[model samples]
Target: MRAFDPFGWLEKYFSANTLHLLIRAVAVVVILAFLIHRISLYSRYLFKPLWAAETLIFVIFLISYIIRINPADRSRGVREILIPLAGAMLPFALIFSPSQNLITGQTNYAYIVFIWMTVSTALTVWGLWTLRRSFSITVEARELVTGGPYRFIRHPVYLGEMLSAAAVTIFRFSPVNVLILFLFVAIQLFRSKMEEEKLGHVLPGYIDFAAKAFWFWPGPPKHQR
Candidate 1:
């Protein structure tokens, strides 16, 4: 008995390489469009000392994601390569793994994944809009923002990203992706600490804000009583 292949129809008309390239091109176009929209929304207020860091981080994220989604680079050996290159790239890797194809035939699973993606996207957008002009890619205190989602967690943007990474990993169910997610969590925690330190140094009210709000969750920091 021949095994059933849901995506076999795609291969009948398009070569695997061509299909992969098409998928990647679509991904790139979508990402670029979103980034262009975001930059336009924030363009007027983006002129700051820290905008360079923001731009660099965005570029690094885009490049890393594009690399990770390449079909040619999805080999087991490439995982070894990615581990070393997985500093800022780990989050993108977790959120967008090349091994996970976009050809799921299970409607229930697709619906669940869609719901998760929707929630994560909403959270990310809310976090971005809340931060507004104060959004910096690196740990810098332009203004002490403690409203909207920040009222609960100091790093709502990271929290949103974490939710997104979790959703993607859950949808794909890969051990390597779980490991990448853990690494992303560690990086975000370290970044959050650095941000808090910078804000505490620059803003006199940050210490009090830290006492009231959690770093990345609902509760206060572990060191707090």
Candidate 2:
């Protein structure tokens, strides 16, 4: 009787492509589970006027990650689509490729990456929890939430998201990923400015809040007349 060869079976079935697909599948499942968990937790607050916008934002964030994990082909030649898509997807592709060389021997590097991911995740969760029902996708003043993370930064959520995104990019360590991170930062800054504009216009105390809170860092308060 022949002995069972588990290693051979695994090597045969779990090729590079198969492993990449498996990773992508696991990522999708995890993301969906997280989203469902958050939705369930916030179910009571879903009836707010800005619920649609908040839901849209969540959907967009999820979709962006899904696309990043399993990106489309770049041969389609759409420059606008390819740039961001390539930036997000190429890192994973390289990481999973059989010919690629990863720094597996560096234990400290791995530890740092783990720490970065943990901190980023905590920041993002803190921002979300602090926002609670006040969270809105658009720049509408659902409420001027000044407690928790908002006390230090006017846009703590953006800061958290950007930090998480940066950590992911750093883990991958690619120029394209850096470009994507920069682009994301620019978008978040613009969004923050727009939100401030709307809040300042609608909420009477927003000016005071802005004057007291930094945009996304711990610094001197904004100058107000």
Which candidate tops TM-score?
1
lDDT agreement of model 1 with the native: 0.57
lDDT of 1 by residue, 48-78 (tens): 3233333333444455345533231121222
**Per-residue alpha-carbon lDDT of candidate 2 for residues 1-225, written as tens digits (9 for 90 to 100):** 113333235657677446545644675676577667656655554233233334444554555444432221111122222333443343234333221124335667655655665565566556766665554343335566788877877877777667767766766667666776788777667657656755666555777877788765332223422
- Report the number of the highest-lDDT candidate: 1
**TM-score, every prediction:** 0.55, 0.54
**Residue pairs with clashing backbones, model 1:** none
How many angstroms is residue 210 displaced in model 2 relative to the true structure, after the best TM-score fit? 1.2
Error of 2 at 208 (Å): 0.5
lDDT of 2 at 150: 77
Off by over 4 Å in 2: 1-104, 216-225
The TM-score of candidate 1 is 0.55
